[model samples]
Target: MSIANQIIKQFPDLLIKKDEPLSKYTYTKTGGQADIFIMPRTVSEAQAVVAFAASEAIALTILGNGSNLIVKDGGIRGIVMHLDLLHTIRREDTCIIAGSGAKLIEVSRFALSESLSGLEFACGIPGSIGGALYMNAGAYGGEISDVLNSATVLTRTGELLHLERDQLAAKYRHSTISEKDLIVLEAEFALTLTERQPIETKMAELTEARESKQPLEYPSCGSVFKRPPGHFAGKLIQDSGLQGKQIGGVQVSLKHAGFMVNVGGGTATDYLHLIEYVQQTVKEKFDVELETEVKIIGEDA
Candidate 1:
């Protein structure tokens, strides 16, 4: 039997779909499909799927909230797992324990409700806890590395491991999790007890700033390029006169040059081509190399 067939046989009760359209899940609303899409509700179920894939030598891709990712037009092979059902949050004194699939916005709101202060910067981030930790997500001068105390992860071989903050080696849109291909199961954040009003005020301020600056109305993978050393990606793109540039249905967000928005019915090929155009244009104009911050995966159509 095929790997997909084996997965179904092993987990008959699990939510599994074949040739699932990844476009429906990604923020860009583009991409082809996944050979097998599985939504695992429990950590044990997730582990089992991982172990099965490892045993079969099948590719396993963790699809987080799809905030900072772009799936290719040809779609992903093997098993694509989404942990949305794992969304849960709990508080222990000044610490917040969030499941990997918990949305960052919800986590930040929970912190505000509990009068915890440290996650205010994540209020506007549109990714899940696992995705955030994977990329060391940051905004408004705060980063995941600043507050993450520890995390529970499933190794590539399906063994559960607990790693401390120091062990994560999180820095500037990177973490050890990506290097080791570990799947985050849960994260513990060390926050401070604070007044509710102040936390709400900060969240509001950050949200307002994000709304004013980002093109949130469109379908985008958030910031496309990382900030080059001593230079902002948006500023560089804007300075290169690449704002409002379009390739197929994808356009450089007029609101923020850092974003490449899917105006309508865009393809991954369009997105990738536009990225290359912008990088070449920016390099020619400013002589600075632009690096992508968004994670592009899967085969090309």
Candidate 2:
């Protein structure tokens, strides 16, 4: 029997898809396929899948909302796990507890509905709660680390753990999740009680700022490079005259140099080549290396 069949047989209740095209999931709308894709609805189901992958010596890839990620044309091997069905959001006193699959934007809106403050900056972030925490996602002047109270995570070995904010070691676009190969299941945020009017105003202002500056009309992985010390990635790219530069179907966003958009029919190969070209051009002109903030994974086609 094939591994996909084996997976279904092992977990009869779980939804499983074979040779699924991952482009349907990624925000950029560009990717190859997954050998076996599974979305576990319950925590126990997730743990079981992790255990199965480990015991069977099959590779496992954890994919969140895929807002800031790139999967190459060669696709991912073995099991690809997504947590979309686990999305749930609720308020607990002065805090909001959200499942990993919950979008940051939704969580922010939830906070607004409850008259809770502190998630205003995430009102426009496209990633899921887990993806936001993994990258310490930030916008304007706020970051996930600022309001995060705790998180429930599962190690690669399928051991569940609850961790405090300080234990996460979160920094600019980084956290211990990647280094430790941990998968976030849920996150809790401590918020302040505020008037609904102020929250609405803040969200509206931020929404306007983001919409005006970003290339939201096209498919793109938000923010290609990390901010270097004392310098902005967008400014550097813009100064390097990289705006609207095209390679294959992907092009450097004219609205924002930090983003590479799939104009139409863009592929993963196009995106990768454009990234390399931008890095090279920026390095040659400014003597600064543009390190990628977006997670690039899977194999080359």
Query: lDDT by residue for model 2 over 82-164, one digit each (tens)?
Result: 99888999999999999999999999999999999999999999999999989999999999999999999999888999999
- Runs off by more than 4 Å, candidate 2: none
Per-residue lDDT value at 282 in model 1: 94
- Residues forming the 10-long window of minimal summed lDDT in candidate 1: 1-10
Which parts of model 1 have CA positions greater than 4 angstroms off?
none
- Residue-level lDDT of model 1, residues 48-68, one tens digit each, is 999988998999999999999
lDDT of 1: 0.95
TM-score of each: 0.99, 0.99
Clashing pairs in 2: none
All candidates' lDDT scores? 0.95, 0.94
